[model samples]
Target: MARQRFGLEGPSHTGHDVGHWDGLKAGELRIQRCGACAEWIWVAQPLCPSCHAFDPGWEAVEPDGVVYAWTRTWRAFHPSAEVPYTTVLVELPQAGNKRVLGLYTGADDPVIGSRVRGEFESAPDENSWPLIRWSAV
Candidate 1:
């Protein structure tokens, strides 16, 4: 069972929490990277799709990026998800134009290619996990 130690209870590994805190703790926007081909890949992969290399690793990345794509969800995808949240696809120029998907805060509509920075929001008082919110920079 997931512990409620943090007010915002989240998955530790199976879902969203996969590499979540591990990334934050390292001060990195840790996305799956292919060591052999040196390509940043998303949606989680054990192998590199480009070079077919099994030598995958996590690397630190800058929080800065441009909005490659985005959407405003009026309906809740998760019960814990706050409605009217803006989800963004951030294009990391430093990482081969690979996009990092995250929730955008402080706005309803976000433009494609808009500058944005990652914000690590505290995961409520009792929660020990690292939660992040993004916004226009």
Candidate 2:
């Protein structure tokens, strides 16, 4: 499942999250880092809440990670998503241990601390956008 599965359509890529979407389009995982304190910032922010640095820089990080947490959705959180899809919060070791959420795809359910890797999946429909999905390694 992609972000569009929830009708999120990902980001507009015109504002704070531009670097993130651009990186995704380029098949890279880029996270914002504080220029001053080197704090990793996910969900994009204009300034570092940790050090109050203005405008963080985008840096590519390894897509390899591990499942920090996971849940199998049995409820229809959104109409576009089929029931019983797995969603996971993956912690990137190369990215200051920042955890990011994504749809999980694999032969088996994800377990906590399971090794995983992220990959970009092309949009399935006009309303969707390319998004990263995680799979067990």
Candidate 3:
């Protein structure tokens, strides 16, 4: 998640998170998996917390997931964000139930354990990156 993608400026780049970022740029949702134990890792990690292995590999995952949790807030969390937004923690079954966070844009109210699908929207220009928006399945 580059800060520039959200109209901010700072060191949003991460050596470990690059794979996830690159996947977003390619319009795919990527998750890191521990090569040794095959356990899914989120937020990126140089070493697998599961097996104490080095350099988990990244792979594209089925983007659909179930809503594990959610929150609605009036405050804009990021630059150029509209007031009053919902953020969801989605758990991908195929990705070992590893949850990923994204903005919820579904018309219906967010409910716990509701099924949702990830939608990728390309950035307006090269200066920005794509975002993974969530909606009810």
Clashes of each: 2, 0, 0
What digit string (tens of lDDT, one per residue) describes model 1 on residues 19-74? 54578755567777788888777766657888988747777777889988988777
Q: Which portions of model 1 show Cα errors greater than 4 Å?
A: 1-21, 125-128
- Which pairs of residues clash in candidate 1, taking residues 3 or more apart in a chain or in different chains? 6-126, 6-127
What range of 10 consecutive residues in model 3 has the weakest lDDT sum?
Answer: 1-10
Ranking by lDDT: 2, 3, 1
What C-alpha lDDT, on a 0 to 100 scale, does residue 128 get in candidate 2? 62
Report the candidate with higher lDDT, 1 versus 3.
3
Candidate 1 lDDT score relative to the true structure: 0.69
lDDT of 2 by residue, 1-137 (tens): 43436658567554888888778778888899988899999878989989998889999997899999998888886767777788899998888899888888864779998799888887678666678888988
Tell me the tens digit of each residue's lDDT in model 3 across 1-137: 22223454212556787788788888888899988898899868889998999999988997899999998767767767775677799999999898988888854578888899988877777776678888887
Q: How do the predictions measure up, each by TM-score?
A: 0.74, 0.85, 0.85
Sorted by TM-score (best first), the order is: 2, 3, 1
User: What TM-score does candidate 1 get on C-alpha atoms?
Assistant: 0.74
- Residue 27, model 3: Cα distance from true site in angstroms: 1.8
